[model samples]
Target: MNSPYSQKIVQPDISLTICGYSKVLEIVSNKWTGLVIYAMEDGIIRYGDMRRRIEGISKKMLTQTLRQLERDGLVNRKITPAVPPIVEYSLSGLGESLLVPMKALNQWTKENYSQVELARENYDRINSGE
Candidate 1:
């Protein structure tokens, strides 16, 4: 039986000119990266504060996501010289630019989450032969 939810897959055009965008998407598409960016939207935040604010993220995952964002030039990392190293993170100009679109996306998700969850439940029930 053909499921109504099933559709033909469309392959994306991955030419050299457009492929670079994939790298940007790869950076932001992770589970924790967007949350980290949103957490920093208020202002510069220390590592501990960010970790506490973003629940369910492990120390290792947060560290890795921050490092990746820094490397991609979306985030700035500042290290203070002190007995206990004080490391802080904030969005760079490029990162700030992302906030507008990210905020729109966040708003859309908040508005549509129930619809999305219902769709998911429907899909699951249909697939499960229930």
Candidate 2:
């Protein structure tokens, strides 16, 4: 049976313009990246240090996010040729600019968590008839 939703997917046309929300979302949408950036805010400069602070983040994901941030000119990676290797990651000037806004976001989330929890409870109660 033919269904209206079963049509073959086609790429939608996009103009050569970027939206502000898209730009912000692109930078901050990665779950691990935001935590990494927040961790770096408090002088976290070493690879192992960041990994430890952001518990459960896999090495591969951390590496990939760091690379992406570096490519986006948000973070700087320094390598020291010690006996094995000493590498440090820190925010670049451009990256530091984001800290204020990110911190605001963090603060807002903290402030609104109680309201969010209440909303969720109300939603669950209404939906479950309990």
Top candidate when judged by lDDT against the true structure? 1
Backbone atom clashes (below 3 Å) for every candidate: 0, 0
lDDT value, candidate 2, whole model: 0.87
- Lowest summed-lDDT stretch of 10 residues in model 2? 11-20
lDDT of 2 by residue, 1-130 (tens): 9996589758544433556767877888999989989878865389998999898899999999999999999899999999779999999988999998998988999999899999999999889964
Predicted candidate 1, C-alpha RMSD? 5.3
TM-score of 1: 0.81
Clashing pairs in 1: none
Across 1-130, the per-residue lDDT of candidate 1 in tens digits comes to: 9995467658644664478767567777898989999999988999999999999999999999999889889899999999899999999999999898889889999999999999999999899975
Superposed model 2: Cα runs more than 4 Å off: 1-17
Error of 2 at 76 (Å): 0.1
